[model samples]
Target: MTRPTHLRIHQFAGLQPGPRLLVTSAVHGNEVHGTKAMAEIARQLDAGQLTLRRGTLTFVPIVNPLAHQLDRREGDRNLNRNLRPPVIAQDFEDRIARVLCPLIAQHDGILDLHSFQSAGQAFAMIGPRNNTGELEPFAQEATESALAGRLGVSRIVEGWLSTYALGLQRRQQRQSDGSRRAQLISDPHYGVGTTEYMRSTGGWAITLECGQHLDPNGPEVARLAILRTLVFLGMLDDAAVEPHRPAQPPEVLQLYDVIDREDMGDSFEHAWASFDAIKRGQQIGTRASGEAVLAPSEGRIVFPNVKSQPGTEWFYLARPSDRVLG
Candidate 1:
């Protein structure tokens, strides 16, 4: 089995006990903005400008260094999927995810870093609000009241990690004591599929999509998000946050399906950025054969593909609802 590797950094201020935060970045190596945000936050905090009112903070930047080094997805596959470990293949992402999930579970709170292919707006992701039952560790601040009051996101979306963890818990409950307990399942929040595995074990986690990939402003937005989280978790005082518009609900939805298109032979005409609405029966794209692909329902595009792989997502159409959000 391939052993997992990770990097960690910490900052502390004052004698009081505060919320412990695990801030991670670069699960997807291309998502460098989050890593930069981590550095920036560390710099500001260590400078003592952004003092921790009550908690410890840890950051793991460049979680998938090999993928970042290659500038390609892990082993030519998307690192965001299939995060089972014990390293049967001894590859990069698997080892990294295996190591990171446990570390995230150790903290009182977590904020994994990420970025999108298209232009993105910063937002806090609250996993489908209801199932905080299994992931009580992560859900300490996941209630609708806390999100609305602190993070300012009223609409709660189902997270891929929350779904997988809850499912495992239910399955394990059905199993006899003699049956082996199920191991963790990795998920989207971390570059590993196993974030869900940690969630199933009652861990806390959140994936923060800072902004557009490679955009000049991406890092700054990520940096701001981290600071905001610190404040929301009571790490910093309100003075750190500049007065801004409250975060509107993000269509509160689940990831009902992800349509992974195979190859560039299929072309999508026109621009379809994230949050752009699509109507039912609208022509979203076309195949090389000129066959039409239509929207199944009236919904908005969550993650559209300008860059994609053959047999991978060209983009995903998200149905805004609890049942479909995960």
Candidate 2:
């Protein structure tokens, strides 16, 4: 069966029925690698360079076209954050979510392509490990992590939604006035992204950050990730993709907390990059009140954003995990 391409979505289905997979890119307007890679894959399919072996593969090259049109991270709001269909469609991103959320829910699995603002090696972010808790009841961690390890990246990060939930809780306690809260989406699960939303609908997903936004190697990284995932999922033939093996076993990191900027004057101790290691008691930054912000433990910093507004996450802290990847 053929579905006509619309809303920047390209669908290719095999004659034999199999798993349905979704691949999305440019959920953040400024992330171009995914879009570039998607275009290449589409071109290959059109030119008969690659063929869908046994499944339906869908690609949304520009999930947030308004943001992509402006060449910015967002047009009105971050589409990647607070990702769910809005009842009223309040903002530009909300409208995109209305269309995107259902597309995500129907897939068996997904690989959301993204690029970060900071300098860092390409890594994959998986959802939390399964527990009895209701906040994030995920039983697909093992399945997701195994797929992540084969994505040509040597690092995997989890605990993103859990860490952000803690940050939101801490922010609410410190903030007396609701002024700062108005600046962000009001959802308690504000950290729910493409992958999280997919997990909620009983589909496993992975967010593959393919390197810095403008990294010269970004497109290739994204392209390889797509191909590797298709082959690993048995949707494409292994001969269609290059053999990928990291130099060592991938390092799994558990993000424990987010450090929010308290005031406009707060700043970091140095020019920090993503995955920079921190030692206990080392001053990582200075608070607005003139006190040094010291590391609570020996770990690594992730997603250090100098331009974050007050009461928003400035950086994240993570420690090594003992997760055994399949």
Candidate 3:
């Protein structure tokens, strides 16, 4: 079978049949750590230094080559969002998605690697059990959750769609009076990224944010994550791999709200970083009209992007989730 010309897929098949795993990196052009890690993994496998004991493993080092060449988040638009079957390939990402989604659907597990703009510890974004739309028949929420825990990250995030929907609802609520509230859109079930699409196909998937985009540690994290996943899936012999201890049980965080830049006005009060702690009522930013943007509640700030466009997410607020599973 021929692969898409725009991207590359490095594949390895074992003698014994087993689960099929798809690991992708550089979905965003600028996040190159995962791409580098995948390259190294490919090299090791090619040289016979690493072996797949069972099943099939496919690695797409650069999912968005044009964006990677441009050194931007996307070629034309955010490829991670609005993942659905394309009626027509109208843009660069759309064309790629059309070709990529079908391959993703064939996998039993997926790991989409990424990095953030701000400095922070690595974490895995885990989807909620209830979010599995069509893929629920193939894998259950408990199975996906177990797979996420084995990724060697210290933090796991859930409620991604709920948080995004909350942001949209808040925006609509502000636009309307209490007597005439706008009707909120129904949940699409599928998210805008590779993981969501994979889950929708009944395959377990997780998005690993391997720290800051340019951090040296990012590549290492990505490398280890891949190795850990192989070991976790029993695709590799642990005795043959280097011995390493996994991180302490991860802390589960449930994102509840997101603040968009459009609602915040012109600029932030200060340069905010991801995972910054915010006290209730603290000034987080300033509106164009000189109004202060205060923290709605005491929680940690995540995904704070100072350069985000107006009407797009500026930052997210999250609290410790009571559901902690390893």
lDDT of 1 at 299: 78
Candidate 1 residue 117 C-alpha distance from true site, Å: 1.0
lDDT of 2 by residue, 1-326 (tens): 23222368899989999989999998888898988999999999889999889989999998888877788787677777688888887777877888889998889999999998889999999987877688888788778978998899989998888888888888767635554245464458688888889999988999999999999999999999999999988888899998688789899999999988889899999989899999999999999899999999999999998888776789999999887888
Q: Candidate 3 — which residues are off by over 4 angstroms?
A: 1-5, 130-139, 170-191, 240-247, 263-265
Q: Which stretches of candidate 2 lie over 4 Å from their true place?
A: 1-6, 176-186
The candidate that achieves the highest lDDT relative to the unseen native structure: 2
Index of the highest-TM-score prediction: 2
Give candidate 3's root-mean-square deviation (CA, Å).
5.0
| Model 3 worst lDDT window (10 residues) | 178-187
RMSD versus native structure for model 1: 7.1
Give one clash count per candidate, in the order shown.
Answer: 25, 0, 1
Distance from true position, residue 257, model 3, in Å?
0.8
Return the lDDT, model 1, position 321: 64
